[model samples]
Target: MGIKSALSRPLAAYVVHRDRQWQREPVAAQLRLLRRLAATGAPTAFGRAHDLGALRTPADLARLVPVRDYEGLKPYFDRTQAGEADVLWPGRPLYLAKTSGTTSGTKYIPITRASIGNHINGARDALLHYVHATGRSRFLDGKLMFLSGSPVLEQHHGLATGRLSGIANHHVPAYLRRNQLPSYAANIIEDWEAKLDRIVEETLPEDLTLISGIPPWVQMYFDKLLQLTGRPIKDIFPNLNLFVYGGVNFAPYRAKLFESIGRPIDSIELFPASEGFLAFQDEPGNPGLLLLLNSGIFFEFVPAERFFEANPPRLTIADVELDRQYAVVLTSNAGLWGYSLGDTVRFVGLAPPRVVVTGRLKHFLSAFGEHVIGEEVEGALREAMTQFPAVEVVELTVAPRVSADPGQPSRHEWLVEFARPPADAAAFAGALDGALRRRNTYYDDLRRGNILVPLLLTPLPAGAFQRHMKRLGKLGGQNKVPRLSNDRALAEGLVENP
Candidate 1:
């Protein structure tokens, strides 16, 4: 074994042991974290406004600080961007993580010195856990590439500002820098296509063992590599084994990815966002991601069904129940107070508190009162893929298709880009519809009442989704197409262009 791999084994064991000790007492750890965040925020402008000094418990925080999304907290963010210190957190923020906003034009989330470790070490610990679990530290000696945004930072009021991934690029530990791929120049290339080509060239000859990125982008890299070399990914880089991914459900892309690689390999899932590194898969074959209890972020969950109520109950980790969907709220050391993260999640295991991200709060389709969430759609697709093993989906999105004609019934329209189209398309659609109905009672009711017809499947040529994203100037770098929309905006665009 190489020196780095040999050394990593002991470190991995130590980290795993330390991690499990805290995981054993999740509720206590979370309560302690909440108190720390409250105390730390007591000196900030927001803290003073919310009377954070008197807060001693989760109930106290919920009473004092209202849950707010980006627009609701824009005033404080504006102050921070204009060089104000201690507006949100104590003193000045070390960096600003720039991210795309839907209603707001651009969002700059603060990354304080105390909070940045949550982002960096969360990823490090994920790999360390894998090493400890499987004794597979040899991958450390090979090229490890993180498909991410440019590391180039643009200064905003003297604070280094860039995409979260770009900000993370600066914090990659020195030990693994030697094994990192795509060179500095390649990573800095502005255009994604150009950068991808450069990455392909730079790593083509290297001993690539692990790759980490959002699933779709990583699939793009795999496809490009195959196009250039005409070899299965396993043959191109024999050492390549682990694929670490986040941002979207991997079920839709799993079949295609493994097909490209020409073999099944291990993968690790992470639930990370600009706001915080929330969770990571701690065990092989376990679908749930172990929620980070001591990561300087205190989590709250509001029942998704009651999230829009005037005063929804915000429950702490100790109060949440298994299998119930809840919208995630954050109060972190990064100075975000009761920040609505917009993602919905369900706890699969609560002893140590493991969750699966279900969908975004605003990303569901309820145009016709049949509330179809991202998890349902993705789950439905997985069922169809299972039943129709010949089908290979590249990308897919669902939107409501309302009919103007009184005689015509409304239906959900699925726009799918297929690498391999299903031979029995009708049967495949039936399987998807059946699976969705089984999962969602409202949808099943609508179908039985003839309020909506079976979903319509519209196939698009390969690269259609990629082209559409490029047209919207969201070609790469943390952009994802919504799995379901209440309106026909995304669906119409795809159909018009295709």
Candidate 2:
């Protein structure tokens, strides 16, 4: 057996064992593990505050610990950052992952040694599961390029702090490190353009088989590679066979990204965050990711519709029903207890418990009593973009255009930065408006009643969104354009960019 196949044998076996274990006593298995976590964490200030020591069951734990957002938990985080030991977890964390979430301006997610181990293990399991399902291990013989943030972490309160990708870069397994592209020095450069240029310089000739990154940035690299080499990706790297991505929905970019590849390649999705490694696509033909139950995180769900309730009902692994949207909550080894991740997902299955990310809880447009979410907007845009095949969307956002005059009805405003500008902007906007009306009943009703006017489309100058992101200090890697903002904050910000 080759090196990767040999290593994956045992790992795949473990994954299979865990899968079976989860299937045969899903609730009991999860509860048993959660109790152990609570017991271990009982000595911490947060645990004691919630009386975690006395909690013996999932129900008991849920009843005692109220769900909290990052703002609510900031006091505890402040304590930890001030060098207090055993505040949330067992000891002082080695680093804090800095993330700029759409809702939360800036969050410092604690990263413990134990939690980082889970992150690393979860990522490996995802690949191993891919190997097991596809019966393809030879690709592992070639290099794997991870398009990630810089490896250089900034120190905060004597502890390292950086993007989750940057923090993860520090923990690349020794075995995989040899197969990973770009030298250590080159990977640590902070400027994204500079780092990408260095990566291209270092990896162009390497035998890259697997590529992993958020879809947009990866797409950028592919565009640059094709521009520089004057050859399709398949011609540049014949060994390329896998594209693993997450952080943004791949539906809109799937066609464009695949076209760049110029050949069929398998793709996998991951649901990872700075707080924890949540889920990964395990089975190839499956629609949803396997909900990782035993992976160092105790999972909970609050109904999406009731997410903002003063004390919404928090459901455990056993209580979740298929086809219902829920806000994801977690108490993980990372020291975050009863914390809402601000993400909404729907359960597609219950037997093995699989889920698909729906959208962000805070990311919805409800300007005129018509609640349109990220999924709807993106789906509409993707459907409309099909008609204009020549137009490639680099970035886009939508906001309500409230009319100043009573006679003029409100409309939706779209600020789109296109890589391949459309042949006719007015026609493109009409197609998009039609698509949205067709997909969403509320939007259709509004349009039919003349409650809303035809949507406004502004084709932004190239790099407008990038310049806006740079100004906000959220330039690259995991930070994406908010598809449906309730207000014009994002739209105005991008429009103001020169």
Candidate number with greatest lDDT: 1
Could you give candidate 1's per-residue lDDT for residues 1-498 as a string of tens digits?
999999999999999999888888988998988888888889889989999999998989999999999899999999998988999899889999999887998898999999999999999999999999999989999999999999999998889999999999998999889899879999999888999999999999999999999889999999999999999999999999999999999999999999999999999999999999999999988999999999999999999999999999999988999999999999999999999999999999998899999999999999889889999999999988888899999999999989878688899999999999999888888999999999999999999998899999899988999999998988877889899898888998999997
**Following a full C-alpha superposition, what root-mean-square deviation does model 2 have from the true structure?**
2.1
State in Å the error of residue 414, model 1: 0.4
Off by over 4 Å in 1: none
Off by over 4 Å in 2: 101-105, 386-391, 420-428
> What lDDT score is found at residue 66 in candidate 2?
80
Model 2 TM-score, 2 decimals = 0.94
